[model samples]
Target: MTCLFRRIRFVLPTCLAGVLLAGCAPNPEIATVTVPRAAQHVSPAARALLPDPNPPYTPASYQSRSLAAYYGHMQDKLLASGKLRQDTGQGVAITADQLTKDFIDIAMKDEYMRGGSGTMHRSMDSVLRRWEKPIRVFTVFGATVPPTERERANALVASYVNRLARVTGHDIQMTTRENANYYVMFMGEDDRMPFGETLKAAIPEIDPATMNVFKHTPRNQLCVALTFREQNGSPVMGKALAMIRSEHPQILRLSCLHEEMAQALGLPNDSPTARPSIFNDDEEFALLTTHDELLLRILYDRRLKPGMTQEQALPIVRQIAGELVGR
Candidate 1:
């Protein structure tokens, strides 16, 4: 058998460490990527249903590390059975060439790796590294969600949670807010101010500016969300706060939810070449594809450690990406 992972001479790019580090007064900079809207999306039918009421108080949620770990193990039993099938994707091929290209494009680039004007050309392995720990997600909704809306969000979450678990192959589980590492939200149209405030309170020692960024939406972002990782004397673990505008069409909101959470898991970049994938700014696929699943698998693979540089992990990534394509 040929040894696929051989040592390579690639050097660690300069900025990746800063993106992954933690400390007070440490650069208040973190990679923030915009999930730009697809070139075009059809608008859903509008209605003037009963107005949504605001919450009496701004709401926030968090989980203890212990419970997050414990329940994550409980979820492993469910995810162990998930199989990424080649035939599950639409218009995507089951070939190694495409898989190799995707792994390199996604795993080795920063979120801003776009070429000048409509072409994606920036390239580097400066994307943040990995989580040394399991992550559990919990869903919360703004007061704007009616019983019917809550049912829709919760049902969608229930299924997406399983997919998240399978992709990470880690202790990625979903339970009530009491023990979640990630707090997913369904925000009402009127809840933007309260929602941003909730985020500022939920993350500790976060930048005032970063927190403030959440308060405003770019013209291109229909449903918006962001993820942050905190380091407690160890490599940081990701916690995401994802929200979809409750008043938007069901399909558009779901697309936002999918991209934000998945991007939070370390593959923070979007590549035009990634086909039938949620990572693309293009709204090509509504669900996770085999290609996307394999990328997540590579990120969480045992051969790659949490803080390893792209150069350090490249060989192992090559091996794992190849295996995912073949198997």
Candidate 2:
């Protein structure tokens, strides 16, 4: 009976191993083209990106403090150049699908010092692709500010940084391009990779010598626009929403959520504070939008588009330009 029991135990162990091996075979091939990440999912352009995963699970925030440090270094460069003038805000529209797990891995390994941990907001392994629309912010300086008043100029620069932080809920350090004077700060939504990465790749090489076109456009072209006064309530957002719906019906709404300046602008990559801000403890803002803002230049085309002649176009262009000048 002891001999029989030993034989049965050995056979049972061998059978279990065989069963496990049989279950390890590769899955059958399915013909499918890998999805390509196109534009910011938070924009109307978002629909052009890819679909969200079913039974959706919130991804861990992959905000990188290390990258924000690089932003600080870049801001120092712009500030020292004496080119940056007024405090400015800018945002990039990036397709999260463009970000690959491999790219995140490589960046963290090389550029950033994050180890193989969830702390950096990267996925553990390959999975279905998703989309995000993160907005980056920075300060812009005025060209006529005169280079001689360095002290006042720096103070102005700091104020601009504060205003930008207040507007987008990002506490970003400003940076400048090689030839420019102002530092371009960047901030994006939580764990949204391509959005932040896209701006980081662009600002360092921006030619301040060329022109400040961003000065003439909306703060974040990536997001639908909403104008708020110093003391207005969410009802103001309702007006913007009505405009979006009446003027542009085809666009899809992403996040009209208002984010708090005090909370969102503090520490870098703080996921808890990065969510949409509410007036009286709501989950999101009363703000509204359509996905097609990138192509939805309703205001631009209707009021700002230049005509065939330069003279014909200057009025509209200048009017919009003046608004951006913060007058």
Candidate 3:
């Protein structure tokens, strides 16, 4: 059965090995696009809540540099061990039956549940959720992040969002923060404290527990996404917020972008059995996989509506999976 609640998904720093190493080079295509500066789009209301656009780069900047180095080292180790596969096409062959099961596990489950007092507890249960309205993604960056980095992030997100739209057949596009229903913020170490106010300004009804997690997310928790339903007992997602640690180096940051943004769309749970997919916690795939594209297609398929119980959705999911896999 489906349970209605806000869903928060976290991507852990799991390791695996594979070929097809993802190069750290920035995309030349995205670089050509003239990205609007993030500071220019910040609303007057949100401006006061956010960190300064040009704060003195000092202690926090130092910490962020250190973090970048550490994560860079970690990425090197992961690459050496053959983890973080960017070649999505070269993974284990997935069958129709396996795809169906994976869809149910990833799409119809809640990764974190909220207690009566508004604290989050790790729990698992059925919950069918997806966006009914068009998705407009807006990104914001912390003061410490440089202009070049911001441009790279903007281009990456824009390109990825378009790819997602094409995969899901959903109306997803990047917009200004003022007009976006989905907010993606890249915050550095110094921006942690002020991030709460920024979130409050953006979503006044945000849960304190969720804010706490964003403010003090553990280093191991690479990135997070929180999706809110229209109302209690409702399955339609109305808003979403994703916080990515700006300290992450390029590949890890892109990995976070792929997983967290996709999770925010609806697939909020990870399955160890999900092969060659970013939805799995194994970190085998650094980017969205061919398997994952099919999953998104199934999620937005017209036959399976939001709030559907597992029993109500599984038959349709299986059929869709078979059709997608040509079974």
Index of the highest-TM-score prediction? 3
- Cα deviation of 179 in candidate 1 (Å)? 2.3
Give the distance in Å from residue 196's predicted Cα in candidate 3 to where it truly belongs. Answer: 2.7
Q: Please identify model 1 stretches exceeding 4 Å from their true place.
A: 1-91, 113-124, 232-235
Ranking by lDDT: 3, 1, 2
The regions of model 3 sitting more than 4 angstroms off are 1-60, 111-124
lDDT of 3 at 198: 59
lDDT of 3 by residue, 1-327 (tens): 221111234321110002212443221100000011111233567646744434444345677787777667767866776667888755578899999989988888655544556465665556567888899998877777777787898899999999999999999999865578787788887777775665666665455655676787655556766666665446677777777788888888898898878877788777778887877655567899999999999999999898788899989999999998868
Query: Please, what are the lDDT tens digits per residue for candidate 1 over residues 21-54?
Result: 1121122111233222111111222111212322
Which candidate tops lDDT?
Answer: 3
Lowest summed lDDT across 10 adjacent residues in model 3 is found at 28-37
What RMSD value applies to candidate 1?
15.9
The parts of candidate 2 lying over 4 Å away from their true place are: 1-63, 87-307, 311-327
lDDT string for model 2 (179-233, tens) is 2222221122332232223332322222221112122212112212211111111
